[model samples]
Target chain A: MLTILLQHTVFGIVTGSILLLATIGFSMIYTTKRFLCISHGELLTIGAYTTYIFHVFLGWNLLYSGVIGVVITSLVGLAIARGLYEPMERHGPLVLLFTSVGVTFCLHGILEFIAGPSIRSFRTPILPSIRVGGIPLITMNEIVIISIAMGSIVFLHVVLTRTRIGKAFRAMASNVDLAMARGIDTARISMFVWIYASAMAAVAGILLALVTSVNPDLGWTQILIILAAAILGGLGSIYGVMIGAILLGVVMDVGVIFFPSGYRAAIAFALMIIVLLVKPKGIFGGE
Target chain B: MFRRTRIVRRVLVVGLSLALLAGLSVGVARAEEVRFGVLTSLSGPLGTEGKPCFETIQWTVEEINKFGGPLGMPIKLFVADTATDVERGITGARKLITMDRVINIIGPSSSIVVAIMKFCADNEVPIISHWSGSTRLTTSGGEYQFRTCPDDYFEGEVAARFMWDEGFRKAAVITLDTEDTISISDALKKRFAAMGGEVVVDEMVVGGQTTYRTAARKVLAKRPDVLFPAIDLDTLKIVYRELYEMGITFTVVLASNAVQQATMDIVGADILEGVYGEKPANALGSPGYAIFEQKYREHMEDGMVGWFTPNMYDAVNLMALAVEVAGEATGKGISENIRKVANSPGIKVYSYAEGLAHLLRGHEINYEGASGSCDFDEFGNVLGYARIQQAKGGQWVDIKFYSSEDLAEAIR
Candidate 1:
């Protein structure tokens, strides 16, 4: 029982880390932009597929494709913010939310047209498992997933807390009108947020392709859970988002020990509802 | 002036009559053609299954056309891809039935077969599947649903007998949460447990999630000697790879679904070595099947036949044969005549041309198809034999041929 529990925890942490990368970006966007970006999944798909084109089609190195995929995704994120969302900013977040859904379907249709919806995967570098006490615990791909997540989390934390632009981002998110009145470059900050958050999402997407496989539905599958984690933590709070993602992952994996694995997604959502019923603003919302 | 106007009007009336005759002739010519629709994953997760099945369908249809098609009407075929999505399956079936106005339809993968079968049946378009093994396919679909392969019940019995024969007393079962896979899991558990085999772990898992490491570990904790995982090839790819990375290997014998040669090539021999699966023994030494394989090699880039490819061939031929048997081309006609053409108490026919002649001569003919006998039971399932096989050096090699008679006795 002890070994099983420990092993499940390890599985939880690995799943949690991927969710962390996905959730943090989602939380940041909702914090500043104040609308759910349903097309975020397509953003992840674009990133993974771009890397796929590089590795599979062009015969580039996987690591090189990963870097290029992230850069391209961040650019796409910025372009979307400028070309679609920014132009519609005056219409309010509700309209933006609806537009995001439209964007999602459009992107999905386009990707399906281009790629034809077959599942594609990368031939990743064979990584060894880190076994302790003569039992295989976790794979090195999982380790890479966790480390990349942690590195991004740390980077985001520093940028948001220690930099001038980070302070401006916070100011705008708290009150966009007030920040604009105070002569803060709110558009610039929003763009920066879009780029950074999208880069993180791309990183998550590439890692997912490495660990699992990539299909057009990859983003759509992970988005709801990322939203659940972000909402479970206060959407505006970075630490809250991180904690919620890890908790969601751990709860989902460990809960299967008690419940059937088919209800794994349900377990995570049920926890979110219970937490919300107790604290409507979310676990970290009161802060 | 009256005579001149009358002559002009008479000329106009004669011209209109001649045009009407031409239109009627065109309509008669059009009616001489029968349309068949194919709904399958031409591009998607089941592309490996769908494309080959489609190719086989085409080949069968082409050969029939050469021999003067069913009811002596040239067969017109239209294909729609579900892309292995359920919603798309429903849409494709609708388009085929309504927009395309096909008299008969065939194919589609098992995952989408339930919804599409229901849709096709509701529209009075009789549909046949190569991969559908779900009981609900017939229960809900009634006379419209048909498949060329045996039901999960037969598959379960076959798998259990193999496990027990191999001296596996304790089994661990993991299945995807799909209705078909669950049915397989249930059938397998029932058969295995009835034979005094203990099912230590039975886990129904949701597919498409990132990792199943926890579920795999949970199964390992119980320490079952054999594992029977009924999952898609893609999900198994992840599960097997994860287990390999974790240095855990369980003796696995999967359902016929896992008998994918392409998957074995992709996963490689290192992980797949000694993994057992079963496919219908139709590929072995049948003169009819040999011709089909030769044709397939000439047509497809990948020459390795998927399990359902021959079934698709059988489905198309059955669709054509039913038309010949009924002497007309309509959904209701095909639905009524499908069993008569495919089921028993008849002379055995091996090909479309043979079946058509037998039916034309007032003979009840059973189609002993390439994929088995295209023989169906009350539930629209057929009894068939499978070739027990094992993965070695990135390919599936036949271990033994398990006959239907022996399987029946073992299960009974």
Candidate 2:
């Protein structure tokens, strides 16, 4: 019984790690840019597919291809922010939100057209997994996933709290008009946030593709839980999103022990709803 | 003048109603050229399988046309690309039945076949398929619905019997939560239990998820004697990879759904070795298949046929033979005579020409085509042949072949 519990928790952590990285960007953009970028998930798809193109099609090394994939994905996200969202900034939240939805469809269609509908994976040598005392806890790829998730959380913490740009970003989130009047250059900062967060999500995508299979719907499938994680941790709360992601992951994974696997997604949302009912401002109570 | 106007108005009303009645039902087979609907995917995900299935069926039509095209009228194939999708398939099927006026139609892939079935049933059009393998299509096999391939239900039985024969006493089943997998699992559970094997664990995980580790562990905790995974072909390899990571010791026998090259290639070689499963392949020992192979090679280089191409070839030939047997080019005519021409208790004919000749001479003809004996039971599915394939080295090795009857005998 103890082994089974540990095993499920391990699975949950791995799931939460992926969700953390994917949702971090979503929460960051919401805090600074002040609108839910619905197409944010497609950046994850673009990342994995671009890596696939480099590694599988171009025959580059997986590591180098992953770097290139991340770079390319960040650039695409930057372009989307600058090209689409920035220009429509004055048009109110509703217009920008609908535009993001349109952007989601366009990006999805483009990915479907280019990559086609088949599931693909990188050609990598399979290594034996690390098992302890008859319980299979982790694999090498999963280790990489957990490590990256932790690293990104720490990285985001330092960049937002400790760095000078962090203070400016906080100022913008607190009062955009006052921050701009105080010479913070809010527009460049918003674009910077998109690029950095998109790069982080792309890293998550490559790790995701390595551990699991990569398909056209790779990111779209995870977007719902990502939204739940963001909301559960308090929408637009960076640190809160991290905690929410891991907790939801563990809950869904362990929940399988009690409920059927079909209710995995439902488990995450149920926790979010419960948390919201208890504290309407969410766990961290983001402004 | 008033009397003349009233006469004109009455004539116009009668003429308009007659035209409207004719427009309600689409064109059936016409004089000079007979229209037949080929509803297969020309593009999209299943297009890889769909395109080849369509080509082989198209080639068979061309071959039959050389010999006067089934009842002295040239067969005109009105092709509709389903794009390997259900919505497109439904729309394309509608166009074929209501617009193009085809006598009979070969519908799209498995899921699409289920979707457009009611529409075709309502319109009263006969469907011949090589792609659809879901058992749902055949449960209460109605008129105007028939497939020239084995359905998932029989494949499920084969898995159960195979597991039983392999000395597996305790069976665990993990499958996708789709209707097709349900059909396979339902049959497998019934048959395996009837054979005195205990199903210790049964899990139906949802598709499109990243991992099924929790579900896998839940099934593994039971420590069953064997595992039967009716998972989605894409997810199957991923699950096996996870199980291997977790130190899998039990044996796994897969359903025929996982028997494809694309899957094996992505999953890699040697990973699935000793994993035994059944796949519907050509009847290598049958002369009917041998001759079909020879002709196929003559047309294309390498002459490789995909999974259901032979069954599709048999489907078209059966349609032609049935058309000749019925002596009319209507859906009713073909549906009534389909079983008569394909089933036994008649002289077995291999080629379309041979079947046509036999039918023309007032002789009952049974089609023994590229697929094994093209026999349709009351369920309207052919008793197709399947080869038991075990993954070895980097390729699927054929251990042995089993006919539908052979499988039934073993189950008995």
DockQ of 2: 0.38
Q: What would the per-residue lDDT of candidate 2 be over residues B167-269, giving only the tens digit for each residue?
A: 9999989988765567777878988998999999988888766678877886778898899887766677577788878877788887766666666666766
Flag clash pairs in model 1: none
Tens-digit per-residue lDDT, A1-287, candidate 2: 78878988997899899889988899889998788888888898999999999999999999999999999999999999889998898997788899998999999888877776466777876555788885678888888889989988888778889988888888888888999999998877887799987997798788777777777777877778888999999887888889989999999988888887779899998999999999887799884
Instruction: Return the TM-score for each candidate structure.
Output: 0.89, 0.88
The weakest ten consecutive residues by lDDT in model 1 chain B span B133-142
Local accuracy of candidate 1 as per-residue lDDT tens digits, B1-412: 9999999999999999999999899668658898999988776657666766887888778889998898788898988888777888888888888888887678776667776666677778887888877645544554877788766767787788889999999999889877667777788899999999999988777888777876687677788889898887668777777767765556888776556765664454566788898655563566557656776787778788666877788888888888888778888889888888788789988788788778778999987777777777665677666767898887788887866676777534
Model 2 lDDT at residue A66:
92
Clashes of each: 0, 1
Per-candidate Cα RMSD to the true structure, in Å, reads 4.8, 4.5
Each prediction's fraction of true contacts recovered: 0.46, 0.40
Task: Please provide TM-scores computed only on chain A for all of the candidate models, following their numbering.
Answer: 0.95, 0.96
Query: How close is chain B to the truth by TM-score, in each candidate?
Result: 0.87, 0.85
CA displacement after TM-score superposition, residue B260 of candidate 2 (Å): 1.5
